[model samples]
Target: MEIDFAEYQLSSQLRGHEDDARGICVCDNTGIATSSRDRTIRFWTLDESNKRDYTLSKILLGHTSFVGPLAWVQPNDEFPEGGIVSGGMDTLVLVWNLVTGEKIQTLKGHKLQVTGIALDGSDIVSTSVDCTLRRWRKGQQVEEWEAHKAAIQAIIRLPSGELVTGSSDMTLKLWKGKSCIQTFLGHTDTIRGLAVMPGLGILSASHDGSIRLWTLSGELLMEMVGHTSIVYSVDAHSSGLIVSSSEDCFAKIWKDGVCVQSIEHPGCVWDAKFLENGDIVTACSDGIVRIWTTCHDKVADAVELDSFASQLSQYKCSRKRVGGLKLEDLPGLEALQIAGTSEGQTKVVREGDNGVAYSWNMSEQKWDKIGEVVDGPDDNMKHPVLDGVQYDYVFDVDIGDGQPIRKLPCNRSDNPYDVADKWLIKENLPLSFREQIVEFILQNTGQKNFTPDPSFRDPYTGSSAYIPGAPSKSSGVSKPTYKHIPKGPLCRLDVTSGVSPFQRLLGERHSFSFSAECNRHDFSVLCVLVRRNSSDWSASSGFDVIPVTGELT
Candidate 1:
């Protein structure tokens, strides 16, 4: 079905957050409410003189770390002007009085960052990176349980009062009260964003670079593709219009699962939303919140539009530069025939005197042209140096034209996801770029098909290449150091990080490569025991395959 709406145009930019805006909520009547990495929640109100403009009204601070998720409540006796609920990296959920902008309650229990929040009447439901869901009533914990085996990243409540949770496990679960009734599985990566389509179903945006529509019954209705990178957030308007934002620096609008418009930005778009009146609002990594409107009267003037266009052009100009690279040695465009392991994975092909960059759109199974490739291009040294640290790769990240070039150091022994997360936090960059930076590290470092460490998941990455006998990170308990004892004599063996006595998987997420070259008897008996919290796993290792026979203490 075609969306019968006017084309969205730039309306106005709202600025106040000291850092990148991460969340936006337009449900309140006072104005727009947004959460940011600045550890503050800001409220905006419309200007009486310039009706299309919004001015800062209030700033609420309570969380000690970056705030991300938001929820709104209607006015009641407890909150005369409605209320605002927010979650943050401080692992606390706060409820604020919309009118006074004062924190009314602070709920604490999560051991990790809170990823999602929803208001259930007078109760508040929240999901966290701790892989659990907690419910609170009257500012007191009412119920809590393990929601997923991995970190829960997104959550939404259906009109029928059922709850849906999306997790780093690459799956969505439908819940009623506290029981999971259905599980939706299709996304190959972390599920980051969730929203209801009202009459249609539910919509999910994922790190897999695709948006999916699924019925409550667990049937995938449609998979929408077009964003060339990690999709951070998605929203739906009652008119059946869907809008999504991505690390690709584009806010794409989709109608019937087909991309109808792509609104470009100078930096990553962290979140997007639709107002009841059909206007669109986008929170961006550039420390600006932009409002797009289909109504001509609300659009910005000619001079403002031109200024935005010039800024976008300037960004593209500085984003890519051919440097220290020989064109003849570059891979041709035919190199795109083989699929990339992840979405937004960049590939540079030799194009005449320059090497053009292309981003893999996994959902479309095609490569989309990004600008020219940048960085060292090809630093094939034994080890790259960054700030006195030797690394397998060091990537130069171009955030903007005037900013200093940021160096992202990576070692083959390090997990790309962990590296990206730490770098983003250290540099105070938007958290939405975690997946994008991971892809960049994987592409430039040539670490494809890397296994992900399931233990410490903050919105998971990598493939399902599990190393046998490795401890699951989500267990939340201490892991036992397992040793392999052979019946013969003890031999000195080279040991790396994860390498056990004889042979073991070294790195956390790296591929396990074991070479057993000891004096082989006709048959050798290998006993492996892993004990933790009164549970034990015993395995028999043979030439054929290591199989877990039973449990022992």
Candidate 2:
């Protein structure tokens, strides 16, 4: 098979996930499903009345943590529409009924994040960061083994019924049940993705920024090298096109082991897969799933096509204030010629079109580069004043049952979970109501990213903080009184944060994240969705509390 088009263009942008979109499963041409760090899976189907348009069909909410890999099973007697196998950071592999959006079974055993998933006939095969692979038959664990010494990150079933797994050990093993038939070694770093190349051999993507093709007998075939950062995923299309996503913020299309097209994203491209029609679907860190098509008629319309360009221009034109200073008015390199009045003094200098921050080093007698300056959200806008203090929002929360309304103060940049936790602690409310309150805040504020922590304290209750997945003492978990079992200490979440609203959370604590994402406007998108950028905003200090049942959901 061969590709007929010379170039590809943006077809559509699917937006719904509240956090990073992590995995994508294309169900032939029927539909597409994606999992996210937001702890949910969304199914999208083509709107046939409108070509190339996909509409959300269902939302699966079972994973308690970041959902990773997804495998699609064609329609069978067991599942009339189809079936889906999903693995998540919660260490659970779930089988789902695609039509009703219900969990068919929960297969558990892995003690860590479940990374890769594949279907073995009627059974489910899963690999985990815990360094093990397990097979589930009819919802029961039938086989389990350590597939690698390091974390097993990728897995795929071959046509012959044997399984292949890639791992952080930098090796891929061809397995027949518990036996390792052959070991293919070429990746110099962690293997992140694996795909079956139809009648050809196997394909693997790695953290070494390369994609490798390997024969079944442990022989290397072709090495595709173009990605400058970690390649997160790879998929083979029937057209012999290989699509790969990377931390470099690109989804690259390859033909005959050569780079053909590079699609740039606003954030890290986590996963990319091929549709049966040769279109590409990519999951990105910006919490968006975008489609790319070579069909010119299917390309995105003008408004959608200019979105990124519009955002870039808006950032550049509104550079009056960057990190609390008028960055556009900053001095040039000549400002660095004079000695600083004090040690460790910081200064911003204009270098071409960028404002670079530098700090004075008295001992070294030279300025050290700090970082590039970025723009702020809105300088003229007024924040709500509460008790002589300013805040982005002050929400009114009613916990039901005739409870008096309490104030929930928040900044646009504040994590809703954090604010809700602290307000619950202060109001002496049930810590279990934390998620509900967070949802309320998100809905009212039009914000999305809601990263929750593992544990939170009630403070008033004086009980040990309960972890999300741990069996709580209140649940009447049986205690054997074996003191030697060594239960881990309760995690005490610190609610205090005095950092600037302009500052950003380090990317997964990654040491070498892309510098482009640090742009002032880009980082500010975390607080508010920038796609529909708005400035006609006001800070209201009050909210109307809505009544609700005391359900945990």
Per-candidate RMSD vs. true structure? 19.7, 18.7
Query: Backbone collision count in every prediction?
Result: 2, 0
Position 549, candidate 1: lDDT: 31
Alpha-carbon lDDT of model 1? 0.76
Stretches of candidate 2 above 4 Å error? Answer: 1-5, 311-353, 356-553
CA-lDDT, candidates in order: 0.76, 0.76
| Per-residue lDDT value at 423 in model 1 | 77
Candidate 2 residue-wise lDDT, 130-249, digit = tens: 999998999999999988999999999999999999999999999998899999988899999999887788999999999999889988889999999999999998788999999988
Candidate 1 ranges with C-alpha deviation above 4 Å: 1-5, 324-553
Candidate 2 local Cα displacement, residue 131, angstroms: 1.5
Cα miss at 333, model 2 (Å)? Answer: 17
**C-alpha lDDT (0 to 100) for residue 300 of candidate 2:** 88
Where is the poorest 10-residue window by lDDT in model 1?
Answer: 520-529
Error of 2 at 111 (Å): 1.2
